[model samples]
Target: MSDIATITAAPIGSFTAEVFAAHLASLGDAPAWWLERKRAAYATFASLPLPTRTNEGWRFSNLSGLQLAGFKVERVDPNGQLLASPFGPAQLNFINNTTVGDGAGARAELAARGVLVTTLSAALQSHPDLIREHFMAQPQKLGSEKFAALHAAFVSDGAFIYVPRGVEVPAPIVITHAASGSGTAVFPHTLVIAEENSKATVVDHFVSVSDIPHSALRTPQFACGANDLYAGHGAQLTYLAAQNWSRDTLSFQFNSTVVRRDARVQSLNLHLGGRQARHESHSQLQAPGAFSEMLALTVADGEQEFDQRTLQIHQAPNTKSDLLYKNALRDRTRTIFSGLIVVDSDAQKTDAYQSNRNLMLSDDAEASSLPGLEIQANDVRCTHGATSSRLDPGQEFYLQSRGIPKAAADELLTFGFFEEVLSRLASEPLHDALHQLIKTKFKQ
Candidate 1:
């Protein structure tokens, strides 16, 4: 029987009505509309079953080790620091869904320009209609429908940003989410709406507390996060996210981008930490002359598992999209990449490309790739390819002959492989910071 058919009617996770009730109580007097939506979402989540190995979308994933127990709705005190700092003029620091610090100067300036840089709760009260229209508006086309519903049911606070028409922000907006306490479950959401002819950049950083007193006895955390990006006509948006969860943590991040006429959006995700991490990303070109660029880089080591699924949909004519994902594996780690490109019947003259490449640094590491395309338009040009390769022996030997250690030589080659994706970032500071974080992982 098919995986979807074999799915049991009973839910398989730890989420129950009691947990949902506790989560609702934590919100404390939120808008009625949002509360009603949450109740509906919780029902949906409870009805859906966990994904099994028989599911094609979850092929090559480590479903046997997937567990959703031992997590609770908890708050983390802010540590008065930004995990990803100095890259943006406007910044919001969220530790376990609490805002601890912000850039007042940048926020004030953006406010003067009629931009909205505030928390999701605040936006729901101040701009109820606007938030209702754009928040999680897109369908969860990927295989994370249950998780997406879970996010909506429990998510309390996150960053909300809106760029007005004809306005351009000089710097990026940063949102940092950190989990400090063990077993602290966090739901972080970022909603961005850029108006016509507007331009902006957003950075999301996920990190865990370092230097645990007991260290070895620390329990793992759970992070279920989502982001929605909407680019209006003639607008441009650039989004960057870096996930560095604790090594014992389990994380799920879903992303959706909608592009309008003459609009463009570029998003890059860097995955570095987690015992098992899964990411789902979908981009839709809703109008003519729209473009979407999707990029991702992952470094997996020490029995870690990174699974990524992506989709690009061309719903209109004269649309374009490009996707590139790269992964480097060491030790006994595993990585999986699955991507698809779809061109609608009316989406003529569409140009789409998808590629996934993996580099193996150890014989024990494993990587899987699945690339597909569906084109109903005869005039569309869509191409996809995936490749898994190892470092050239000659290059490695040459570096070793120059007194470089074998480990260092491999690290250098890995960096060279990843630079292709990192070089696309427009912000110098953000680029450098990402590079440094990758280097730290290599050192570890």
Candidate 2:
């Protein structure tokens, strides 16, 4: 076989040319434009090489354990369970890339108000032009271009939401991406387009179905997902993603947000599971008065590795952005956070802030942070910092003096450390849910 043929003939990690072809064929009668795009994307994915330890972007990442060969692309018939609590106004549940839950009522209600909440495939058939215009429109500024290409080439199904101008979605839209079956690979996508003066909130949940023990050999799943948010002039958009994949799963999530003139966006990511997980987020202030608030919380335990990278770009004058990330590390877990803020020459009066804090609960746990800035404008107000500290001994002692057990007291202190980032969410329900999730992680 030739070089290209050999690479495409067999499984390369979890993706091969044969698998890509099968995925495309499964789409049966998709739009020609989209099909062509997938073909091109596959070509790109096959040609580019994976990240290496020497790459600056992949620094501090667990490059040794990154494997992609044993997974297969197939439909998984998972016994999926919907969230116990009320998710939101609209909830779409998926089992291995297939929407399995009923969202008819929510869809009907939104349809009456000119909102579109449905599967990406349906959107392509009904609104091809809109999908074509904004699908993966933002540049993948962070690393993981190769994986992004792989996602575009093999993505089978996901959620599509659109809010027309002047409409405000009273309740948030929810999408659940669940994976099951041993050695299964899934690609979940979420695309949101908010028109001028429109407002909406979207929450994405990533999970894996199966009661397998948290062992390296018992469970292994591959997840590559991406989300795009486009806020038109004066629009308001809020997005949240909570990932709790299987402990033996390899997961990747890429996010891009574009804020237009006078528009604002707030995004929060809660990380709780995965053996080796990497998340990349990029936010762009495209026009003046644009503002973006970025927040993230993570609970790293056992031998898990959580790698997060972010970029904030002030492309226009008078734009602003704020970012706060907090992580609690226990056992031998490892976490990495690298963020950068860039201001263009004309982006004067750009007010930006970035901070990452880690609370170490174990002496062996590892945490690394790289926060930087690039400014071509002299009149910009930008500040960035990263901090890693252990639990305050004095506070722990004080709690113990009050009759609280040492273990419970430590957990309380961790919650207090995370409350700073959790309090930024305007939705009380979301805040509470996240708190409960973190609390559960500690109990485990």
Q: lDDT of each structure?
A: 0.87, 0.87
Q: Model 2: how far is 229 from its true place, Å?
A: 0.6
lDDT per residue as tens, model 2, 1-444? 143344344325667777788888899879989999999989888887767655899889987556677888888665655444334533677878888878888788999999999999889899999888888877787788888888888887889999999999978888888887788888999999999999999999887776454432337889999999999999999998998887888899999999999999999999988999999999999999999999999999899999999999999999999999999999999999999999999999999999999999999999999998999999999999999999999999999999999999999999999999888888899888788877778777
Summarize candidate 1's per-residue lDDT along 337-398 as a digit string, tens digits: 99999999999999999999999988999999999998999998898999999999999999
User: Best candidate, lDDT-wise?
Assistant: 2
Which ten contiguous residues of candidate 1 have the minimum total lDDT? 1-10
Error of 2 at 322 (Å): 0.6
